[model samples]
Target: MTDSARPRRATLSDVAAAAGVSQATVSKALNGRDDVAAETREIVLAAVAELGYRPTTAPAASSRRTIAVTFDIPASPYILNVLQGVLVAATENRLDLLTRLPPDRAARGQRAVGRDWIAEQRASGAIGVVGLTLSHPDALLDAASEASLPFVMVDPVDATHKRLVSVASSNWAGARTAADYLIGLGHRRIAWIGGPEASDAARDRLYGYRAALDAAGLEIDPAHVVADQFDAAAGARHARAMLGMDLPPTAIMAADDEIAVGVLAAARELGVSVPRDLSVIGFDDTPQAPWTTPPLTTVHQHLDEMGRMAVHTVVAIADGRRPVSRHVELATSLTIRETTAPPPA
Candidate 1:
């Protein structure tokens, strides 16, 4: 065959044929769809690599793409990380991104602004919606399902209703990691400062803290578990209450970095020395964790990965790919810093 006549490019169809799969299967495997079996998907990927096939980047295809992302709060560092991953991936694919913030940041609530936003975007030909920490209304979830808007949630919803497509870090595991760290350091008189009553994360964190105590053959002190909102001020309030108790705890676990900082401040005000008179461990290792006075020992939530997964799931669904489940949970790790230590003698 003449060099000019030899095919210079392998197409998706060629890869599918080589892997003995459908064209759609090849697309799913290449696009990181979670629907395909791991082994079969790996085979398809290997075939793609062997065939040196690349997806087309024609303007016609590029112009057909747009995504709307709604976040629970624009001010949250965690949400900011999620947004970064979604925006970076979308930009790389030459997709248009429309970011929406909740109507009232002060209300500290998530409004399904996504539904109305989705309607307008759909009028302009948007393909899907990606939401981070989305506390969507039931009607909005129903609307997404009816409209087939390819909705992807960043994490699990507090209440159960179907139609939630999500990719999330394991809050339970993150909390467990924090508890394990405290246990390993010989902190037996531990307490937990949780978030609001309605938060899925707050519940998971509380469970983990209790699990660790149970494993150590310790009874959970009801008075030691203080649940509050997910803010520094709330943390301070809870910490103050805990500190004021006649028999205060030796260590406290906060559900987030902000709460941990509040605890630290409260400890100082009450003349309690961290890691000496008291120990504080937290979750979400926010950027502020290391900056805290004694630094903070906390759980490392993979927010960037969560964001990427949410975007990938939404975009894949938009392209007619079905994921394995409506819910996806990612893993989390622990970051041990200087804040926690053995209880005082």
Candidate 2:
């Protein structure tokens, strides 16, 4: 055939472009690298087939699978504990676990950026994704859906997408239990310090606390309710202010263990002895909860189980099975420690 009439042969670059992945990823996928996610491999293979691209070397066979997990910075005990469960489940399932940070906030809201982010995940061989306390995930979730990638969120923050699948602790019930316990302890002036206003878990916990007070026929004290960051600093700041009030609360309920730690610090600074002058209760019985001064009495949420469930849910979705529910809430129990007692007379 004349050179002008001959069809152009497809190159590796063409396949990579078609697959929306890097050339390195294409090679890894073709070579059956264990690090490549199964879904990513399938994408590359499809591109190769569509473009009729052929490598000089024959492709290798492999059965490795991977999932991607994304989280924010300054990882807390709750996050670390949940990660432990994710790692264990990934190992048990014989899958590779990839950890990542989300894209920059400035660009993540753009549709194209979100799509590219999902493509990168697919390129890395991730068939599914798990997000831990990921905030503003609507764009990413939309892109994942368009690409048919399975995604699960654990304790998501500020996520409003209706199709989101997630796993979390029973926040409302847990908080209510904590409040009731304080009431049972003869602590009538109860105060609440909560997590961020945008957190659904935080809102649920606050509602639970209110519900408990209502059930006990106690009036809600707006002055005693404070919503702020989930860190110890926010907790300490709020606690100090509340403790300094002319009619101070006899007990305080914190949204998480970190915040509860700050509450302890503030009480100490003010010379208020725990369970003597005041009682404190916190949510999320993370590993650090038991190590707090006087060992914090907090609500026990199975964080690891939530992580394990997230992996299982994503894997099941990838297998073309729908989850039993879009949202799953694990049970919570109260872990009584040295920080709670009857209110000082």
Candidate 3:
């Protein structure tokens, strides 16, 4: 599509002018500043909605040094939080940031992103890329290397590849911490619910769990380890299967919050009381974690920091600076909520 044919993005200034208020007033109203009058806030909001104004706190890009954050799927549930962090960094750095939701064929893998796509990015002044889950494709990397376009991956599916520059949480350490916490609670029979076995994060977390078990002289129960998608449905299915065992686990550590929520559902369905009879722990600590029936005990991954650092790394690469490290792994911590307690007598 031609530039002229594209819809013009409504700015804060546009909203301010339409609302008959100063730009700062519009900003305060949008940000919920207490000083803004309720009537003025409503006017600004109405103008914003009418004008289709989207906030981009960042300064405009001068048609040069634009950074593209590409995703595998447009509606991937986890991108919103990460995008916020990226935008914050983009704003601070005064860089133009845009998201590219590649078509399935263009996004499946690095090799899948065709030569035409690379040419298009180069033509559009996209000098750097921050990829969510898209890993190293030799061809795409080669094209990037030749074009000197810096590339960085956020939470890649496989982070072990030396060629890949990725930002990820300390999955192994977080998993180990969860396992140890369960052991500390006097739970002998602990089950694990993890995502697809192929994922590096999942694998690392699984290994960490096992490492903790080994350290505590507990045998890893094969029946308790289930590999499924990181969703409530998968959690429910796995939890049900585990709960059906004659000697079910007293505690279950799920790899993601969605799965943890699923475990809670299965527990409720099976008449298993959380924490009293069965303790549950999850990772990622996404927003939904705290709202589950009994709340969720989770390992928090600093996703926003990861997003912020991703922009910083990619921008640095674009600026012709060689980073001291190609990969960055942020720390993880445990958030104790309502779902975990000492095992039943």
Give the residue spans of candidate 2 off by over 4 A.
Answer: 1-61
Local distance difference test, each candidate: 0.75, 0.88, 0.79
Best by TM-score: 2
Model 2 deviation from the true structure expressed as Cα RMSD, one decimal place: 7.3
Q: Which candidate is the best by lDDT?
A: 2
TM-score preference between candidates 1 and 2, better one? 2
Instruction: For candidate 1, write residues 143-220 as lDDT tens digits.
Output: 556556677777654645576677777888788878878888888878999987677778888888888888888877
Cα error, candidate 2, residue 74 (Å): 4.4
lDDT tens digits, residue span 1-345, model 3:
999999888887898899999998987775546899888877776676466454443223343356778875444445666777888988888777878765354453554254434444543456577777663344555545544567788887654445767788999999999999999989889999998876778889999999999999998789998898867899999999999999999999998888898999999999999989999999988888888889899999988888899999988877668766787999999999999999999
Q: Can you write out model 2's per-residue Cα lDDT over 1-345, one digit (the tens) per residue?
A: 999899887888999999999998998986657788888887886776456554533333437788899988537988999998999889888888999888888887787677767766765667789999988888999888876778899998888888999999899999999999999989889999999899999999999999999999998778999999999999999999999999999999999999999999999999999989999999989988889889999999998999999999998987779899999999999999999999998
Colliding pairs, model 1? none
Q: List ranges where model 3 is wrong by over 4 Å.
A: 1-64, 73-77, 103-112, 135-139, 159-161
Model 1, poorest ten-residue lDDT window?
A: 106-115
